[model samples]
Target: MALFGIRRLLTILLIIIRFRLDQLIDVTRLPSWLCILLRFGPWRLVPAPQHNRGARLRLALEALGPVFIKFGQQLSTRRDLLPDDVADELAKLQDQVPPFSNEQARTLIESALGKPVEELFGHFETQPLASASVAQVHAATLNNGQQVVVKVIRPDIQRTIEKDIRLLYSIARLVQHYLPDGRRLRPVEVVEDYELTILDELDLQREGANTSQLRRNFADSDLLYVPEVYWDYTRRNVLVMERIEGIPVTDVAALNAQNTDMKRLAERGVEIFFTQVFRDSFFHADMHPGNIFVSRKHPERPQYIAIDCAIIGSLSDSDQYYLARNLLAIFQRNYREVAELHIECGWVPPHTRVREFESAIRSVCEPVFEKPLAEISFGQLLVYLFSTARRFEMEVQPSLVLLQKTLLNIEGLGRQLYPELNLWDTAKPFLEHWLRDRYSPQSMFKRVSHRLPGWLEQLPNLPEQLLEGPRRPIEMPVPNTDIEHLERQLQQEKRSYRWRVLGIVLIGASLMQAELAHWSPHTLALGALGLLVLALK
Candidate 1:
């Protein structure tokens, strides 16, 4: 190993020992040899801190530095996938990371943007408004006198992250080799996903593009607002964007003082979530409390102003359909359909028994349904459903992880806004409408119309291409029951449709003559003839 890697490993080991993180693990069920070592060997020499397990874990990660701090920040949003205590503690990491010096921030910004801070901004605050694992933000004004926020990436943090990621990969391989269920946990894959997300966040231009796309998605929306990205001032390591004035989503007292309609706000939060997930299929994935704010202009009709658009989620068509069906099935308490849908969608092994999976789903969902929709927890229910799938060895959909995290965050924020909010009822109607529109005839017609031009472009060469292929040798006729049956079925369907169209034309002809009995015979005859032509279709 390289010297830095070896030193970094030592530092991590020291932090782990100093914080006594091993105490967080339950060693009672471990193998005898390991248990004895942990209990009696030098490992026990270090005294554990007298703090809550969650607090100690958080402090340990913070001590490890920014890369681990970013992991904790991400974990904080995924309350559904984590224990409440740990997630609650990790939530502090979202905006609580200690900031780098202002001089360093200014130097990094100047180097990245190719301009001095003074020339670019009329005034810049030396103290950071917010400090995150990857970057910190400062209040600033453009030369045009417009208020904005300047975000600067930490200098030399990327090297630390890369080194830590290598260490994580090594640990993942060790776990996969030594632990029986380590593959199921997919620790390596999870860390890789985090690596990509955090690395993407380092690119301010990418974030600028994400911000612009989100702003366009909700350009006319009142429920949510996205800040405009100042592209001219954005670069790989520095970002400038329009500053928003609003109350932080976490400040319950301030919102109450503003006379905000808490119920409407909470319900709107759910609506916005469904709209993003179903209607647009694109969502702001990093929606922690720190990244969200509520506009104070309208107390009666609250609007959300979101910042930090580094992570986004989108669903494929198959995923969208299956996920919707699964949610609807869960809502309806149709465990059998849920199980069948999982198999049909290839979420679980094809050979998995439907009855077994159905029973498991029933057990997981039944208790959740016992509570009133207003009192039930969306995150908990989803977590239970996902947990049930794990028993069937269902492969997790990597892309939807972001959506799941965002849902957990939204659920948390909604419940905080209004305890009585019925997320189920608020979101059910929207989902039903989206599904209806997805399968409607008008929707089909729109899709067909979109592809018709492409089909037309390919039409002229299709006949030539088919004829260019080598002709098959003549063969003796063979009796095939399957082909005969299929031919008969197609003929029957064609005859039926032909008669059906004829009947419809005859009825239309009679109505037309009745409406214009005094019209010319030739015009009426032509109309009847045109109606008859529909049978050919």
Candidate 2:
């Protein structure tokens, strides 16, 4: 380690010792020698703090600084990993940080935008509206009289983050090497993932793009709203966006004052989440209460206003399909399908015993399903499922991890809005409808139509490529006897190839017409004719 990393590690050690967070670990689970060492370690000679293990851990993280605090926030979502008390305490870890001087913010913004603060905005507040680990926001008005918020990255934060991240890697290595469950817990991989996420937050331009994409995804929709980003004023270190006014989603009293339909608000929150994951495939991953608000205009039909698009999650086509199926199967209490889907999707090892995996899933899910639909937590169930699957050697999917965190945030927000919100009732129909649409003939036709042109372009070379395999010395056939046989065979193969090519062409044409004309009788006839041509071979 470098000098800075060593100093940072020592500082972390002091804080850990001060808080006595080592007690949070289960010493019995460690190797015998290590367990004995920990039990009689000199660190234990110091009188322990009065706080509980969870509190001590949380306090130690806070004392470590922004990066560790952020890690605590992420860890809190993994209810499947940490004990309940510890997770609850970590959930209390806030990203709030003291703001740098206003003059420093101004200088950074001016340097990023190549202009003075006065030239950039008609009015800019001297005090920050919100200060977080990576950046701070200030209320401002554009010269065009548009209300906006100016976000400036803390000057030299990158250096601080890099230093802390290096120390984190070092600590992760130590934990992985020393702890018994370290490989399973994946401390190193967890740190690597966190590094990518926190590093992304430093690039305001990427965040601005994410905000714009989310706004476009929810455009003209009442369920959620994303503020417009001012591209001209945006930079890698600075972002300016339209300011929104609404009740914070956590303020239940204020929302009630506005006659908000609490049940509707809660259901809409679930709808927004499903729509983002299944419908758009792009979702705001960091959707904690601080980044969400409720529009006051439509109390009867609640709309969510989301900000802080620094972290977003998306699913690939296969993941989306498997995830939807897994969710539906879980809701239907079909553990067999859930287990099968995990193996088929490569989430779990293919060699995993299906019945054993199914039994494991049932054990985790049956207890949860015993509760009333309204009381069950969809996110918590997923956490438990993932936890069980880990025993079958499922590698963590980063996208799914983000989705899990966002789901937990949404569920927490919904239950806060309305205690009796039935997440299963809200999400089941959506997943079913999406799955149906996903494999419908029209969808198949659309997919085939997209690839048909490329297939057609490649079709012309197929016969020649098939005939001439790899480069090799040509063998002369026995004079005229084999020549006639070769000629006959060539003729027969050409005819077969032509017939197959015609069948494919007809099939492509029929699918295109069916998609365009809504599957009329003519298109059906064309499809049948293509199948008949293929059958003739």
Candidate 3:
């Protein structure tokens, strides 16, 4: 099967070359003659012909099977990876792939619950409300007259994904060997990340847990609503959750009908994003229109209803803190601090030129500074930052890319609903207040108080671990044998910590360069902390 998959891939590659896709991709990095050979090689599958290249590419990926479809889905998020036209076309490929039969869905749900369909719900629609590469959702209702929705994983999607993933690995190996940009793109690594995400999405149980947690996060707030996950009816392949009725966030006319405060709605969108990113660090990574709805109950104070919790994101604790700091710095036009923070956070190299980065940031940000706060574009700022960091060899962060994409989608939707939306102004207060509370003395006291029990419990063990770090037992191996092995392990662990510290420093510097000088103190403090961690080792 593996051999056959590769054979089919080779055939597809032959066709692509025959059609001059090799030339379509940037060839400046490859030798001219080699590029020509790649386009018109001995694998003469077909003569070059005019076609909608983007659609052809999508179709070819589908032919190659689920792995490539998944790959294309991810690549769609990376506007930086492909030409705008291609990326725009690819974005339409979301969850529109062929779906498994309704029979399979019924079978899987029944198997998961160990019961008949009649016992589960009053009605189960044969047609899916929506179908994606991994699963399908159907509208349903309970016997007690409560509306609900059923989500079931596509049958054999796991096998399909696994098979395609192996093929992708093979393709990545070949590309890395032959293509100049392969190493930089890190295709294999990207595939690995996608594999993890796709597999996690297949597990409805995990999705349920994510929804439940997020629901809890916003339980008291009327800003966003997550449906209750009916655990009693949930299983690995199937999930049942409360049905929500609201205007799609993208439906401007409907929102207007409900007298929604468009300005407030737009502002709240920005606040929700920043809050999830900074305060909670867990955000709905997929905030596309199909997965979001606006509550009609509070027309003047519209709230968002979010579903499809399969894709989510979280930052490292330090990232959460520094991101908040960076946002605050950007608003204050603290470019030097931004640069320094970037370096400290390891978003750039520790040795990156701070002055140059700061100057570059100023050039990008200065033009938009005097504009009305509502007119400022956060997405544009991020693009500028990313473009600037490209010079310093900043590797693309997959998780950050997801966040960037989601933010863009949300911002676009908000602007559509309400023109003259000043995203920066709306977000500035939330970010500012979040940071203030985060670093405030009272907040520190609260944190200490919250952890007091755990700290007290560990107090007695601290002395023992520190004083008795390591001891030679009576029957210990000779020093040369075990000591060398132990030393090697410790050295490896130390190296890992060293790289992590270096990364932090680099990010801090980058942030400072981007006009966030206030972050310098925190960066320095973290550097000291990182050094302490190294010393302890």
Candidate 4:
């Protein structure tokens, strides 16, 4: 495996050299020796391509294979990080690889479903409607005359991905060890996250479930539409879903031709994103233009049609609360609050100086906010904020990074649809409303009501556990007199027993108050009191 990895690494290097991608790197930032080597390498003998740098990069990633192509697709979303031309070229890197043989697709489909294609579907197209690195889709009609698309995982793609993932780890380790900021970047963790994401994509049944959940999320909503997944025909490698017809969200001209309300359409995209993240806590992580469409039925309202649900992201309750608050702070230009939230949420070290962090955040954000509301890029602001936070040693949060990427995609798409779309205006109100609802008394009551039964069930054992503390064998020193030792032990036990009893009584009182009052201030005080008593040594 190590030998194969070395050879694969060489192949990648050769591809980069062949495309002259080294030119893209800033040689001035490199070590003196490496700079000279790159400038005068033997590989430089090969003639450089006539194409521009961006096109060369796109072609080189294509040559590198599916994994790199997917990486390029992800990079394209970060327009804030890459040059506009490069980002634009990378955005054109679609999963339009040459399809495998139709006979192979039929054989795999049959093997997965345990039936012949003829017996399965009323009609199945031999030609693939779309071909991606991981899977390809073909138009089909079920026996029940349901128009659906059958997705078949590419044969042997797993072996290819496995090989590439090993190579990626090798590269990530090199980056982590060699680059000054590599540890801060957490490249290995990022690759691990990417590995999980890509592996999840290989499981068609999981994708089906994701689609079903998303469909249910927007069942009758006008904001977005998710297609129905047919479970009967779905498998680990095979997915069948309702065929959808809509204008690709990227087709601005076509949308304008249909008199689409571009502003409403743009704003709705933002609403759909926040609703998924703040309300549902589940969102489609891979929401590039290719996976999104605009419904033709509602030109005025402009409902979004989304597909490809392989990559999903969700935040913990704490993350949701903190992230919403942080964004609100950023929007309000409350840099001190933003800095404090970072430390409070453990995004930065607890020892981080709040004033210094606040100043850094202000330096990054004040200039951005100076722009007109319509011209401000909310996603870019986040990018800048994260970049600045790196100085304070803020570790990368995989879930938040995914959210940021999706936000960038949504912001770009919204701007394309309507350049004047103020993402701040669309998002602020939604987040404010979500935060209010999340912390409302009714919400608190619901949460308490749900957890009360569990708390009641645990009540019987609480006294014993609290009183016993942690079990450890007692070691007693030799005493001058047995009577003296016994007296000391007795006194110590009495004091310990009293404290334990008091702790139990306070906790019991708190639980009772919680049961009666739900989430009132008195109940909160009692709960804190119980915790404080229990924590006393």
Candidate topping lDDT:
2
lDDT string for model 1 (1-537, tens) is: 499898988998889899987776556756778667767867688888988988998999889877888876765655434577987798776446788999999898888778888999999999999887788999999999999999998888788788888998887685555454556556677677778888998898989998998899889889999998998889999999999999999999999999999999998888888888887888889888878999998889999999999998888878888888888888999999999999999989999999999999999889889988788877677777776787888766656677777887898789989987888888788878888998764464344346445545655665554344323343666467666775676666665555544444443444445456744655445445544554454
RMSD of each: 6.8, 4.5, 9.6, 5.0
Using TM-score as the measure, name the better of candidate 1 and candidate 2. 2
The lDDT of each candidate is 0.80, 0.88, 0.76, 0.84
lDDT of 3 at 265: 89
- For candidate 2, what is the TM-score? 0.90
In candidate 2, which residue ranges exceed 4 Å CA deviation?
A: 26-37, 462-504, 511-519, 524-537
Backbone clash count, each prediction separately: 0, 0, 50, 0
State the weakest 10-residue window (summed lDDT) of model 4.
Answer: 465-474
TM-score of each: 0.84, 0.90, 0.80, 0.84
Estimate the TM-score for candidate 4. 0.84
**lDDT tens readout by residue for model 2, 333-429:** 9999999999999999999999999999999999998888888988888889999998899986889999998998899889988888888889988
Name the regions of candidate 1 deviating beyond 4 angstroms.
26-36, 76-95, 179-181, 465-537
TM value for model 3: 0.80
Q: If the candidates were sorted by their lDDT against the true structure, best first, what order would they fall in?
A: 2, 4, 1, 3
Best by TM-score: 2
Per-residue error (Å), model 2, residue 238 = 0.4
